[model samples]
Target: MSTSHDAALLKPGFTDAVFEAQAGFRALLDALAYAGRITTLEVSLDPPAPLDPATAAIALTLFDFDTKVWLDAPAAAGPVPAWIRFHCGSPIVSETHDAQFALVADARHLPGLGDFDIGEDRHPDRSSTLVIQVPALTGGSATRWTGPGINGSIEVAIAALPEGFWAQWDDNHALYPQGVDVLFVCGRQVIGLPRGVKVEV
Candidate 1:
């Protein structure tokens, strides 16, 4: 890891310097408990270009030298990946499964979510986690969500989701604990849908 002044300054003071980052992490956890729910987090400064508020927030929270990232669109070669490298120090990988963090610049271009890692039988949590940066989400999607965090079902209108994504996710649910978790970033809002949650059309 580079320890130069610039790199050291890039290190998030949130773990020690700022309190808002910790708040964002907590809000993120709560949002994931209920699928498709939205939560807004406050950021002290604007993130680099091609980055939304939620994306910047997460880059600060989960990334480090230990993490590997995969980029879906905008090719991870320009300002997008460079920002991640400068701030997070996460390695970029060519393979999706090898990545601990995957950033999708445009949601429409996102691959079938199931094409990514779904974890494993022994250590299911090892699956790749995705960060999908979408254009806009008016009211989330009307995918009836039911599971641990919800009572009965909750309706949310998600942004543009890929074709047959639900069917593949249904298959993934069968795998139980061994599946991927996804985080959606739009502007400064975020929501998480872990594998444990069930989404029905």
Candidate 2:
């Protein structure tokens, strides 16, 4: 009893489920392991527009039936969420705070970082993870980043993020292990912003 639109929602997923998902997970670890360093997610996926292939790959690798995902307005309008539910079997939640993963198809419409769950002290791993689609990873205003994964400090520029994002990031970073983690994706590239990373705008 599936409509044409519903059928279309089920897009092609990872080319090789096991191997590709592992590669995507490794790429995610590498990105977070080297703060501000751009990592490539090379998995093959044909998700609907506005959902970057890299972001989709990460979704496939990260989400499970037990996970709850929140999609921004623009993302929710598309096939991306349905595709995630189809492949990953994760529940899509209406409330941001209820989500373990939130996907933003348009970075400009992103909600406040604090709107999502930051996790409790006893369960820091319960925090949300944001996968945001940005214009580009470079050619934006440069800011100094320093944290555990960074060698010392690095100059990072991610374009088209909403104004005052870094300021909110400062607040989020203060929460340490309880804060939400982020992966900013554009095309096949992703930049990780772990909760430990500090930004000087």
Candidate 3:
């Protein structure tokens, strides 16, 4: 038998109901597309330090009984995971490849993007979606973003990203419909990096 979400996360006014959860998910989507932008979100949980607004927003939206989550560092233990389990009912997986969603607390701690599943050619959407919790996302980075959705190119600074993360991503792009998508969270904002996007770092 399984315990209900209501029974697990009983903290008054802390758990996000359905309506608020949708809003959080939307906010995350918008922020990722347009970098350096700060989007305000309604954070219901009182998560500990190092868990920024963007990361918290992501946890609330993506975590559910059907979702499998993986965490690195600071979030590997303590209040962050507990809050996620209590509110979203998402299961935690051991390997990055097995996760439906992977939340990396620190960019520096992130393993190679290829370490996680990039999905097969037929069903590329089955790959893991990475949620990177950045320190501060500001505009004016050297990295240029250009893909299907953007008009020309967009530039933004995603704090602490590894040197090769983008380069490897470019290589992955050649694989076409067989790469992982990504979401970058900072402060209370997020941005989407769909598999189709050609990331030129």
In Å, residue 30's CA in model 1 sits off its true spot by 1.0
lDDT of 3 at 29: 67
**TM-score of each candidate structure, all chains considered together:** 0.86, 0.95, 0.83
Task: Give the range of the ten consecutive residues with the poorest summed lDDT in model 1.
Answer: 9-18
> Tens digits of per-residue lDDT for model 3 on 1-201?
235764455333235467767888677666555543456676755455567765766777667799998888767865566666776788888798898898888888887878888988788888888888776666424667777657787775666787778787887777778877788777666667777777665
What are the clash counts of all predictions, listed in order? 6, 0, 5
TM accuracy, model 3: 0.83
Query: Could you tell me which residue pairs clash in candidate 1?
Result: 13-17, 140-157, 140-158, 141-156, 141-157, 141-158
Q: What's the best-to-worst order under TM-score?
A: 2, 1, 3
Best by TM-score: 2
Cα displacement (Å) at residue 55, model 3:
1.5
Off by over 4 Å in 1: 1-18, 75-77, 139-141
The top-ranked prediction according to lDDT is 2
Q: Cα lDDT of all candidates, in order? A: 0.74, 0.90, 0.72
RMSD of 2: 1.6
Total backbone collisions, model 3: 5
State which candidate, 2 or 3, has the greater lDDT: 2
- Over the stretch 118-174, how does candidate 1's per-residue lDDT look in tens digits? 777788878888888876655545678788888787776776777777787788777
lDDT of 2 by residue, 1-201 (tens): 336688665878887899998888899999999979999988667777779888888888999999999999988997777787778889999999999999998999899999999999999989999999998999999999999888889999999999989999999999998899999999899999999999998
TM-score of 2: 0.95
